[model samples]
Target chain A: MSGLITLVSLMYLVSAACYVIGLHMMRTPKTARNGNRVSAVGMIIAVIMTFLIVINKHEATMTGSIVLAAGLILGLAYGTIRARTVEMTDMPQLVSLFNAVGGGAAAAIGTFDYLSLTAGSHISFAFSFPVALDLVIGGVTFSGSLIATGKLAGNISGKPISFPGAKLLNAIVVIVIVAAVVLTIGFPVNAWWLVLTLVASLIFGILMTIPIGGADMPVVVSLLNAFTGLAVAMAGFVIDNQALIIAGALVGAAGTILTLQMAAAMNRSVMNIIAGGFGTGDSNSAAADDVPVNVKETSPDDVGVQLAYAQNVMIVPGYGLAAAQAQHEVAELAKLLTDHDINVNYAIHPVAGRMPGHMNVLLAEVNVPYDQMKQLEEANSMFENTDVSLVIGANDVTNPAARRKGTAITGMPILDIDKSKSVVVIKRSMSTGYAGIQNELFSDDQTHMLFADAKKGLQDIIASTKEYLDE
Target chain B: MSQELYTNIAIFVLSILVGFEVISKIPSTLHTPMMSGANAIHGVVVVGTILIALEAHSVLFYVIAFIAVFLASINVSGGYVVTDRMLQMFSKPKKTDDQKQDGGDK
Candidate 1:
């Protein structure tokens, strides 16, 4: 048993090392492909080792193996189907659901452990305490994560929805869970109390995360993730499993840090996040009145003409690119430009899309070469010397508003797209961004609004540029 | 040999497979945050370990439990810190002049 445990731990160590390599690779848009491959390898190794651990247990039975096989088959089918067909927009929701499952599984495992210990045997007060606590925390995390998944997927509103004394209500639930846990601990034979605690904890988790605003989803995801980790770690304790303990610890600490970072990014307090009700679907979808903004106008043919003849062209992508499903098309366009002997590069802002390095992942999906995807710092420097800056359906990140004072996003920094010599913006319409502010970039003298969906605009430009090449 | 143990093992295997399936669909954008957050919940290992130690009635058990708690705390704390830092950097602005001179958006 010791030897097998050692082997599994060693595999985990190797897997961790691979994760580090993969993280480094993600730093550059070009090397990101390689990074992903490395990470995949690590995951594969971890999976193999996990299997070995499960199989190597001396007392393994046939029922367990059958169960394992069923899970494996079901998981593979679901993952393959989703990976092949799930839209990029739904990715966050899928992830949240997945996280919930993991937490739920861990919590369920703890419950099973408790049930087994008590069944056909004597139960003591000492045994009941830990088991009760485990059931409570795990159950709470599981349900809470489910709600988070629902919210992210837009099945629920993303706005804060605080009711009168929601906090107090949540507090009372927590107290009930604690009280039940204490009862279970004080009377080990009281198995029913543990079950009751589980129910209460589950309710607490849902109430705790439901009211947070959409703007703070990233933070909510992080917090729930932390709860899941702690649940798993607690399970490790009940089973006296070293590997489980170590893995749980790693997860718990990481989740905490992520939650804190996400909260800080939005300039929000963690306490506020716990209080929930921040993003109760207010006016986020209400369209802003399109006040006429100055945008330099240009045609697809003209833009194509510029791209075909330019020495260098930098593609500045924003949330607009993701929304338009334009990444694949954009890659095709870049390829055409490359054939024309034009220097084509993608300048990606750090926070360009909804999440960190989102643009890189989107571009990578279309098989864009890593070297061509430049980070904001590297791309920002090159933009000044570039001949043309093509602005796709991005707004807030490119909005020069971040640079000026007295603005809502003030203290927030943005890409210096304004400094570009010729800025061509391809947007369906002039719309205000998530911050509910108008962008001055649209009005810049050097900027040209192409006024089209990014994908269609790119297609038109691609065809026009092809003509330019033919001529 | 125990049916309960078999049941537990079955559940564990099923959970992982389901987990992997769900994980694959997540957008790469939320990968760090999601992974880091889930890892935090695993900290419950410490609570479990501590509970076991309280019941130990043996010196070796106490030692093992203490070690588990210490390690779990570090993992939980370290992971959360790193994830938070990454998110913070993401929300900050890019340096200006580097972007200004480029005639076109890169």
Candidate 2:
């Protein structure tokens, strides 16, 4: 039996290494598929190891093994069904649900130990602490993730919903929870406070997440994943399991870092994110009403004429690029221009998408070389020397408000595309981003509007560029 | 222990169903913000772990507690890092055609 456990542990270690490699591959858009394969391989190995360990350890009772095997089969079937049917748009919500399942599992292990104690099992204090911690955190993650999933799926309001005295009420609830925990430690036999704390945590999870707007769901999801990891680590401590402790800790740390990075990308403080209700529905509505300048836009043929003849071109991508799913077409256009002896490079702003590094992922999807995607700092200087700066589906991130004070988006950093020679913007219409403000970029004299769908516009541009080269 | 496990499994399944029911109706645009807010609530995990760590009554327990604390700190720091990076866009500039100079003449 000990040998079986050791073998399982060895497999787990190997699987962990594979997972690390897979994650690295997924980071860049180019190798994302390869990364998925690696991760899948790792998961398969881990699953096999888990079964082996479970089978070896159990007394092999027919009833117990049958039940366990049946549960596993059911889980596998459900996962397969969901994976086959879920759309890409719903991927984020699915991720949240999966995370919730992991959290629930951790909490379950802890509760089992607690109940055992109640049934005359003599457990050490060390064991009890981890179990209790896991119960609270895992429970919260499970509930909170559900709420997040609900909001993302559009079953609930994505806007921050608040009532009078909401902040005060939240504070009170937190205080009560802390107080309950403190009292539970001071008086052990009466563990009723622990139960009360659980209730408080559940309510806190719901209330805390309810008021946040839809714009911030990715950050919320990452943070909850961190919680789930921490809860798992606590459970590991209770069970004296080294592997669980290490794995949980790594995930917890990584998830937290991801959350922080996501929040930073939006220029919001974590505290503000937690305490403040985000999104004003009226502001978005008002911003939407900001009428666009109906300039007689140039056609892709004309734009291609300029691109094909120009010595240098810089492509600037924003959130619009992702929405249009035009990255591949843009890549094709760039390749065509490059073939015609025109220099083409992609200028990427750090915060150009809904999340940090979002543009990178989109570009990678289209097989854009890593070297071709220039960082904002690197691309800024090049723009001044370039003949044309093509803007695609980007708005707020490129707005000059980051450097200009007294504006609604003041103090936010922006790309220096204003320094370029000529700019071409491809947009369906002049629309505001999450901040709900008009883009002054649309009115600039050196800019020409290309009013069309991003993907269609890019495709036409690609064809025209090829025609120009043929000419 | 088995009975408790059964109850937990039931709760876990119920939570998933409840969550699915709630999330399926939200519009695509709101998904990002909703997840962000929920992540904040997940911080309770840190507090829970710390509470557990403090309950350690033996040397081995102390070692585990110390490790958990260290890892949790890193987790907190990482969350902040990612958040800061995401927010940097607010101050970033937009790249529009009208704002540029005619560098071709240069």
Candidate 3:
């Protein structure tokens, strides 16, 4: 028995190392898939080892085996189908759902642990305390993630919803959760107070996310992800499980860093994120109004002509492009231009897609070569020497409004697409971005608006280019 | 704290440091996959869930554990599969052999 336990522990160590290596391998594109494979193998090993332990225990029950098998099948089917079928534009909601279920499970574990310990009224201070934190954080992550998914999916208004006493109400909810937690600790023998804390924490999660507007959804999602990580770590502490501890701590720290990155990209502090309400989600853009801005309109043929002859062309994509699933069409266009000897490249903003790396993944799905994709910095310099800049379903990132003082996007970095000799923008409507701000680039003399769905726009441009080039 | 608990804490703290180091190295372009990958990695909690659920005594524990076990497994399996699918899209062979001798560093 001892030997088998030791072997299982060693396998877990191996699994942890694999996760670390897998994440590290993500640094480069070539090794990323292999890295993912490594992590999956690690998880499989960990699952097998745990199953072995369950079977070997003297009180081995068929209940555990049946439950494990059932969960694995359902989870595998749901996850595989969702991942395979989901559109690139919907990645945000999918990820939010993933974070939600994961956190909810962790909280359930915490709740179960606490209940089991206290059913006999033998709760230890050390064990009960972390479980308290686990329940609160996990509960918050679960509900908060669900709300974020709702906002992104448009099921709920992405506009910041405020009540008469939202901030005060939130404060009260926090107080209640905290007070319940303290009471449970004070009277460690009773599990009744723990339920109160759990319910309060869950409500608090909903309250916290409700007032956050759409522009901040990315940050909120990332923040909830971090919260889940922390809760999982707390659950590990309650159970004294090393695998859970290591995985949880790693996730907690990583989620936090990602959240900070998302926040910084929007020129907001982490505190502002927690407070949310940065954008109204009320207007098409944050500052969109009746002020009619002058803009040039160009046909796809003209844009196609420019793309064909330009020494260099850079494509700047945004959430709109993903929504249209135009990556393959855009890629086809880029390929056509490349064949005609035009240098084509893609510019990726740090916070471009609904989630991080969102554009990259979508483009990769269309088999866009990684060599052509440039980061914000790399593409910034290229925009200057470029002849044509193709803007697809993107707004704020290219809106010169970000650079000016006193504007909503002040201090928010933007792509220098205006520097190109000629600019063409394809968009579905005149709607302002999530921030509800109008883009100054739309009115520039060098820029021409080809108002259309991004995929259709790209297709028109591609078709025109083929005919124009062949002639 | 007990010796075992102390050791576990040490592991937790060290893993935090290691995680920050590795995650920082990832570029912004890979952030989504990195986020998803980490999401999958944290599914390790299912082991803890399974351990607790099997020994559950009362009906309350049984129902709660059942749900927890299912949710945890979903997180674990779904996270990995999704991440893998996304990563697979990244390593396609380049079509143009013109050899621009460009400066793309991964």
Candidate 4:
């Protein structure tokens, strides 16, 4: 029995090593897929070793084993199907949903452990503390991630939803959670305290997420991911599992850094996003109506002629591109231009899509070369020398108004598309972006608007460019 | 604290440091895949669920453990599969290899 314990411990260590090495390999695009495979292998090892331990103990009844197996099979089938069939455009919501389940599982484990503690028995601080922490953090992540998924899937409004005294309500929820934790740990084993903690934490999660705007989802998602990691770590402490501790701590640390990085990308603090109500939700349409600025409208044929004849072109894509599933269309257009020897590169803003690096994944799906996707600083520098800048379904990222004072997006970093010789914007209409402010770039003297959906507009431009090249 | 508790704490702290060090190197373009991959790693909770289930004799405990097991399994399988699907796309374009070689020469 002792020997078996040692072997199981060794296997768990090996699994931990796989996770560390796998994450390291993800530093480069070349090794990222293999890295995921390596991590999956680690997971398989951990699961098998756990089974070995359970069987060696001979503690599981036949009925218990059957129930466990059934749960595993059902979950595996459901998860695999969802992962395989989900559209790439909806990857953010799928990720959020995964976070929800992961958090829910951790919370359930913590709750079960707390309940199994003998009634009227003295619970140690060490054991009960982690239980409380796990319940609170896991509860928060589970509910917060579900709300995020709903917002992303358009079941709930993407705009920030807040009411009077929302912040006070949030404060009250936090206080209640803290009081419940103290009671559970300081007093005898009372399930009521745990119940109170769980309920308050769930409400707190919804309160924390509901007030955040759609554009701030990248940070919100990353933050919830970090919460999920912390909750798992707490569960590890409750169960005294080394593998869980290492894996959970690793994810917690990494998710924290990712969240901070995303928040920095948007020039906002995590606290500011959590406070919510940054975006006003289309209220500035009145402002746009007040100013009747001159706008240039162009046809696909004319835009295609310019693109085909230009020596250099830059493509700036945003959430609009992802929304219309126009990545493939745009990639085809880029390829056509590349064949014509018209230098083509894509300018990828850090916060361009719903999640960080989302636009890159969408473009890479259609075989767009990774090298052709330029980061913000690099893309800004090249725009000055480019002959034409094609703005596709992107708005605020390229808006010149961001540089000036007193606007919604003021002081926000923007793509300098106006620095190019000429600019063509492909948008459905001259409307405000997520910031609820008009894009001054739309009315720039050198800017021309091609009013159409991203996919259809790109297809039209592709056909017209072919015609121009043929002629 | 017990000797075992001290050891667990030490392991947790070291793992956190390693996590921060390893992930800081990943570029922004791969952030989504990296995030998804990390999401999969925390599915280690499934082991905890299974352990609890083994000891569960009561119907209430069994039901709770069953749900936990189900959710953790989904998190593990779905998170990894989706991340792999995304990363597969990242590595597919042949031009990326040529571009790397060109950069190497420069």
Candidate 5:
């Protein structure tokens, strides 16, 4: 039995290697598929090895395998089916849901262990500390992720919901939770403190996420994902498992880095993201209303003719494009432009769409060559030389006002679309974006507006370009 | 036991460094898949769930462990499978287009 356990540990080591290497391989698209597969194989091995070791060691309780297997199979079926059937546009919510499950499972393990430990007389600091930590962090992530999903899915209001003294209420909850945690280690008479901590965590999660608006969901989701990872690691310490420690630490570090990255991309601090809320009601900001912005509208045929004649064209895609399911049409437009000897490129912002790299995944679905997609650094430089910069459903990212002072997006990094010789913006309306500000670029003398849904807008351009080329 | 705790701490700290090193290098284009892969790796906690379920001392603990095992398994299996499907869409992008392969995959 000892030898078998040793073998299982060795398998876990192998699985860890696979996960690390798989993440490394994701540096580019070429090996990314293989990277995903390698990590998956690692996971399968870890799960199977655990099964083997668990069943081999338990004789009298072998019947318990039925419940374990049922849970395993059911979870497998539900997760796999959801992952497979989910819309690509809904990926952020799905990821949040996955994080919820991870956090819930970790919290559950910690709760059970802490309860069992308290039933006995001994209250070891080392064991109970990890248990308390796991329950709190896991509980927070579990409820926080669900709230994030609700905001992203529009099932709940995407606007920040804050009442008078909301912050004070949150602070009071934190103090109580901390006190409960300290009590667990100092006073050993009861396990009720653990329950208090759990309840506080659940409330903290909801309160934390509800105040945050849609603009910050990605950062919140990534942070909660990291929290779940940390909780899992704490659970490992509670149970004394090396594999869990390694894997959990890796995830914790990754999520932390990702949260920081997403925040930096938006020019916000992690602390600021946690404390602040953005995107109030639908009222347009004073900036847009204060000025009589001259609007210029153009037909699809004229826009197509310009695109066909231009020597270079660049497409800037954002959340609106994803919401409209227009990636295929964007790809089709690019293909049509190439036929007319116009060099085409896609400029991808780091924070484009709901998640980082979301636009890249969407464009990849339509078989866009990986080489043609430009990161922000490279795309910014290319826009100056391009003849026409096509903005599809992207508002704030391309706003020239970001370069100037005195706006909500002031000092925020933008796509520098104004540098392009001429610009065309496609949108459903003149409504503001998540920033609740006006886009000064709309009134630019050289910019033209082509108001339409992203997919239909692209199709109209494609058809018009075809007619112009034939004539 | 104190020495053993030190070993776990050492592994935890060093692996964290390794995670940052590896994950920091990935471009924004692959962040979603990388995030999913990170979630899947932590699903190793399912191992703990299996151990607890197999030797559950009481009925309540058994129920708790079963729920945990189920959730962890979902995190592992579902996270990987979905991420794999998303990445596969990029497997054979049109190379015939007049653009040079960046070869950044190294």
Candidate 6:
């Protein structure tokens, strides 16, 4: 029996090693796919070893084992099918959904363990403490992630939703949760305190997320992801499994760094985002009244001729481009220009799309060379030398308003598309962006607005450019 | 606390340092995939669910364990698969021979 235990421990150690090595390999895109494979391999080993332990123990009833097997098979099928079929445009929703499940599972494990231990006789303070922590963190993650998924999927309004006394209510929820957790730690056998903790935690999660607008989802999702990891680590303590503790802690760290990165990209603190109520939805009414008189509107044919004759062109894409599914169209136009010996590059802002690296994924799907994709710093540096900058369905990221003080997006880092000699913007209307502010770049002397949907606008430009090239 | 608990704490702290060190250096372009990948790793909670199932004698315990198992499996399988799909696109840009040729035609 001891030898078998030793073997299982060694296997877990091996699996943990694989996780570390695999994550290290993810530093470069070239090795990232293999990194995922390596991590999956580690998971397989851990699962198989766990199964062997269960079989040797012979403690599981026949019905219990059958039910477990059924759950495993069904879950595997559902997850595999969804992952295989989900579109890149819907990646944020899928990721949020996954966070929900992972959090739910961790909370469930903690609850069950606590119940069973209490049924057996005396439960220790150490045991109940981790279980309580796990329940709180996991419960919040489960409910918060669900709300985030709903917003992303368009089932719930993406605008920040707040009611009277919402802040006071959030305060009450936090106080209740903290008091319940303390009571649970003191009285390990009483389940009522833990129940209160779980309920309040779930409510707290919903309250925390609903007031955050869609623009901050990347940071919100990353924060919930980190919460899920912390919950899992607490579950590890409850189960006394080193594998869980290690893997969970690693993920917790990764999520923290990502959340910080996302927050920094927008020049907002994580605390401010959590405070919520940033964007007021797509309020075109207020923006229309404030529209500057200097806005220059242009035509697709004129823009096409300008692009065709330009020496260097930079394409700056935002969430609107992804919303209109215009990646392929833009890629085609860029290709036509490249064929004509016109220098073309894509300037990608870090928070340009719904999630981190979202624009990169969308463009990569259309076979845009990764090398042509420029980061914020590199793109900013090249804007001055660029002959014409094509702004596609993007708003706040390129707004010169971000450079000045007192605006909603004030102090935020923006793409330097205005520095180019000539600028062309494609949009549906003079509406504001997610930040709900007028983009000063739209009223610049060199800026020309081509009012159209991103896909249609790009297609028209491509057609006109093709005609010119053919002649 | 017990010796076992002490060792677990040590392992947890060390793993966190390693995670931050390795992940902080990754480029912004891969942040999405990195996030999804980390999401899959925490799916190790499946082990906890399976461990509890072996001890579940009552109907209530069994039900909870079953749900936990199902959710953890999805978190594991779905996360890794989706992350791989995204990374596949990232890796595709390396073999740009066809795209280069298409762009080269005057």
Instruction: Give the candidate number with the greatest lDDT.
Output: 4
Per-residue lDDT for A369-432 in model 4, tens only? 8888999899999998999999988887887877887676777788889999999999998777
Cα lDDT of model 1 by residue, A165-234, tens digit: 8869888998898888877666544456757788898898889777765545666666766566556755
A1-471 per-residue lDDT for model 6 (tens digits): 788889999999998888888888888888989998999899999999999899898989998898789879988889999999998889999999999999999999888887776542556777878988999999999999999999988899998888989989999999999999888777646767768988999999999999988889989999999999999999999999988998999999999999999899899999999998653334444554687778989998999889889999999998889889898898889989998999999999988888888888898888787789999999999999999999998888899988887677878888999999999999999877778778899999999999999999999999888877784
lDDT of each candidate versus the true structure = 0.61, 0.59, 0.82, 0.89, 0.83, 0.88
Angstrom error of the Cα, residue A320, model 4: value is: 0.3
Task: List the lowest-lDDT window of 10 residues for candidate 1 chain A.
Answer: A278-287
Top TM-score hit: 6
In candidate 1, clashing pairs total: 69
Model 4 stretches astray by more than 4 angstroms = A279-292, B95-106
Global Cα lDDT for candidate 2: 0.59
For candidate 3, write residues A287-359 as lDDT tens digits. Answer: 5664446888888989988887788999999888877889889989988988788899999887786777788
- Which tens-of-lDDT digit does each residue in A245-283 have in candidate 2? 544554565466667756765667677677644334465
What CA RMSD would you report for each candidate? Answer: 11.1, 12.4, 3.5, 3.2, 3.5, 2.3
Candidate 5 stretches with Cα past 4 Å from truth are: A59-63, A279-288, B94-106
| Ordering by TM-score | 6, 4, 5, 3, 2, 1
DockQ for each candidate? 0.07, 0.03, 0.60, 0.70, 0.61, 0.81
Q: For candidate 6, what is the lDDT?
A: 0.88
Candidate 2 has a DockQ of 0.03
**How many angstroms is residue A305 displaced in model 5 relative to the true structure, after the best TM-score fit?**
1.5
Query: Per-residue lDDT for B30-68 in model 1, tens only?
Result: 454446434433433433333333333334433333443
Q: Write the per-residue lDDT of candidate 6 for residues B1-106, one digit (tens) a residue.
A: 8888789889989999998998999887888898899988988888988898778888988899899999998999999999999989988866676666687894
Q: Which residue pairs does candidate 4 place in steric collision?
A: none
Superposed model 2: Cα runs more than 4 Å off: A1-53, A59-64, A80-91, A119-125, A150-157, A179-199, A277-302, A354-356, A463-471, B1-106
Among all windows of ten consecutive residues in candidate 6 chain A, which has the lowest summed lDDT? A279-288
